[model samples]
Target: MLEFVVCFTVVAILGGLLLQRLWHYRAEAERAAVQMVIANIRSALEIKVAQANLPDGSLDFTFLTEENPLNLLKVKPVNYAGEWYRPSGADIGAGNWCFDRADKTLLYLLNNVNSFEDSQTKLLKFKVKLTRLPHSPAKPSGAPETLGVAFEQVKD
Candidate 1:
């Protein structure tokens, strides 16, 4: 009986360790997905700015009208940080989505859009806000902290 008890304890320890490893891997994968989203959005935003007939954060046009310039590109997630082999709701939408070009200084930075409509499908809506760097329209800061997991496996 003593020997069996010892063996069970060992197995429990091993299971715990394995669970920890899996969690670490999952967290890393999540981080990568966030980064990919940031990169893609940044690139699209740059293009919009270049073709923008108004200003950098000008929302006064058709595709990016000053009133509703939130429908820029059909934000879609083709990848999920080289992880999650399945289609993660952590992706973008299937239609054009605009960027909030309205003084992304304090509010924008604080409330950036990390992902698109897809993130909301899995109830992970508003993962993070992707904001443009201040005084540096040519540059952007893709902070990792901003891109965090919003949902977790809920317990019954």
Candidate 2:
């Protein structure tokens, strides 16, 4: 009778521990997913930069405009006619991107630009950013092998 009671107690404790671990993992997975989305955005930009083979070997600002020679590399058209991006059903496509020429501090307009802690947290977050260099490399082959190292620091 004593052994039976001890076994039940052990099982109950183990079950509680498992449930706790599962809950913690669920939250962590969600955070990781959000991070992945941010990471992908950076990677896609790098891919495009690589496609634009510059004369001096660095990605030029000219590649960013409508006259971008590597238009085929863009998922979302680099040069559109007269239309901004259409919003997805759940605001997935609603994002803004801008660059500061003076400071070179590119500002990615995120959907949920929270100022510290706020009560209004959404189900998902959207964001974008600019990746640039000091003076543009003398030659940028735009190779994945070349750009992969820059992003590796941010990935899990």
Indicate which candidate wins on TM-score.
Answer: 1
Which residue runs does candidate 1 get wrong by more than 4 Å?
53-75, 78-156
Show pairs that collide, candidate 2.
50-142, 56-138, 57-139, 57-140
Q: Backbone clashes in each candidate structure, one number apiece? A: 17, 4
Give per-residue CA lDDT, model 2, range 92-155, as digits (tens): 3323333233222222223443321231433232222234445446656663332221322211
- Model 2, clash count? 4
TM-score, candidate 1, is 0.40
Ten contiguous residues with the weakest lDDT in model 1 = 103-112
**Predicted structure 1: lDDT:** 0.37
For all predictions, the C-alpha RMSD in Å is: 13.5, 10.9
Whole-model alpha-carbon lDDT for candidate 2 = 0.41
